[model samples]
Target: MTRTIARLALAAAGLALLPGLAQAQKNAPHNDIAAQAEQVFRSSFRADNPKYWMTRLDQDEAMRLCSQYRDNPPPKMRAQIEKAQMATIRYPVEGKLIGDWKEGEKLAAVGTGGHIGFIQPDPPGRLRGGNCYACHQLAKKEVAYGTIGPSLQHFGKLRGNSDEIIKYTYDKIYNSNAFSACTNMPRFGLHSWLTPEQISHIVAFLVDPESPVNKD
Candidate 1:
């Protein structure tokens, strides 16, 4: 009878401690939670090129700040972040910021690259693409487009192809955070996911009068 009572007391003690453990987890700092999540994410993935995947996990200053602000940084901080990101933008050497819209159109439809799974690294020579259609609707004929971002249909018609507009568009694509801090748009150029020439092509797709983005 004494042994049974002892076991019952121990069970009660363990049950009493459960709430405190739960509360501790609930009160853990955001960084600690993120660390735990990162650990789990890293353990879940198996990559032959671990360094490629591991480097992706490391966040830059802008990404870190965006996370801290929950993608809504205050006005002053927003300006600071924008300025910092703007400084990172590198224009082309030839002083031309436009490329073939045809290439851009192809790139927009492609949603492959940086993919890792049980299959590991992608096949060789599979070029990375902007995958722009995943977010913004550029071409009016595209039946499938995500609404996470505003529709960019008639983009060139709305915004005239002035030098200022062209530069603004180029910079925005190079590092979207340069224009809007904590934006969901990926910093394509900042991360080298796309080269300056490739970004220029995307800009052309958006601003060129003959591009599908502006076509009726």
Candidate 2:
């Protein structure tokens, strides 16, 4: 009986090895694997309503390329990816990319919006916040803050208010990925996560002399 049991275990291990050997012999294409994964994903989540959101699962040109290379493409690939992304960014047509710092401070702290799958959603008057403090240390007064990114306690003081500096700051806040490909920072303007006016305010928050970010 013990001999029979050992034979059965050996047979099971051989069965597993057969599949591994077969897979090694017949390698699946990357696109085929991705398509299979997407099918599995769609089957799991296709029941939900809001068909518009479902379309988001589809990848765009940049997203497809980014995923194809797992966000660490070669230097040449990185530059090509950045150039594709940079073409999508549109600067403010008015040529004035600054707004009220006070309002900007309030918006940066609110942190609400982008919630779905709810029955009776939030009221119409909800204000979305940047929650920049969640990933960055903004001011000296804010005792509790995250440090995923660099601190901006004295952003303006450290980087004086020059037109070029102001433009760079505004553009950085608009689409961080344009500057650094695959950056963890969200593309606030690219995704319409924040409006141009709101972004300008964020720029002001970082560049304005009177803002808390620059005050101390």
Candidate 3:
């Protein structure tokens, strides 16, 4: 009840500032407003929403640096971030850098799991897939793929699944920030969003000669 009242008051105060927002903002201390904004944000979430001790709201070193630079840090800082992120990557135990593309294809298409909110809580044992197609085009058949990232059709045909390419593909999938700091691509393995074996499977889906990503 108190948090709800505070949020409402904050909203009202914000509206009251609209008439002379320019002058008021000029006079307002940024730190004060920032603190108030943070309170409002915190108050907006339901108590249960932040439960389960999830670290989703917490920022790690890389996330902090990325946010500090607005995702475009200096070249030197970018290199530092990438190197640090690279050190966090772990390979599979059996020395396998590629796995079944069929599994990878399923993972790429699945965008389910890790859901939040009281009405949207994920069910037990629900698979948390990488949902690669959400950001990049893999097979020519999935006409609904997003364009946030470059299309990867014919990836193996163009790059050829060489030993170096296999390693590169695995490393990139495990932790894309190792190659490019602040990249939109998630650090699947580093964050444990996907297992090392899962990443290897994704690598195969992109580099296997017979995979639809190449054949199609």
Candidate 4:
């Protein structure tokens, strides 16, 4: 009878622990995989630009939060992220939010910058490009465009060229996460990938009616 009673108590204890065990199993695999993947990535690449490449591995608060939520943070967290990112945007000193659409078009199309491979770094004097077409359909003439981002074919036509719209466009390009937290778009201005002047031009490319992006 004692043996049977002990067995019953053991079963009840196991049942009580099931919830904790299940929760641990659910969480541990994701962490384990992430750690393993990070290790592999760190080991795979030789430090071409040790300072630059190593910094990429380090996650800031925004990056860490985004990863924690899998790019879909809760509304409160999203708002917090947006608020923080919005504070980082820097506008041009000349107070011009728009520039030449032609220059903008060139910036959008040219996609070479900050490339690192094996032991090689990007050659100096190579102007950086937004490579916008890789993720967005801008000009109608570009036959090959990626669909990762929304089609911007009629961006200017639809939104029109208002002061508010222009500012929003420039800010968005500068720090996309400022508007939409955990967005896939790169923070061009925040990272210095594109200068404020370059971003202003790109804004013109999207908002200029004469630009091929808005033309049918």
Tens-digit lDDT string for candidate 3 (118-158): 67678877899999999999988889999898999999999
Local distance difference test values of all predictions, in order: 0.83, 0.75, 0.84, 0.87
In model 4, which residue pairs have backbone atoms overlapping below 3 Å? none
- List candidate 1 segments past 4 Å from native: 1-49
Q: Cα deviation of 58 in candidate 3 (Å)?
A: 0.5
**Which lDDT tens digits does candidate 1 get at residues 7-28?**
9999997797566445544644
Clashing pairs for model 3 are none
Against the true structure, candidate 2 reaches a TM-score of: 0.78
Residue-level lDDT for 37 in candidate 2:
81
* Model 4 C-alpha lDDT per residue in residues 13-131, reported as the tens digit of each score: 77975664455336543777777887997787665556876787788767876886788876766787798899999999998999999999999998887886565667878888999
lDDT agreement of model 4 with the native: 0.87
Number of clashes recorded per candidate? 0, 1, 0, 0
User: lDDT: which candidate is best?
Assistant: 4
Worst 10 residues of 1 by lDDT: 20-29
Better of 1 and 4 by lDDT: 4
TM-score of 1: 0.78
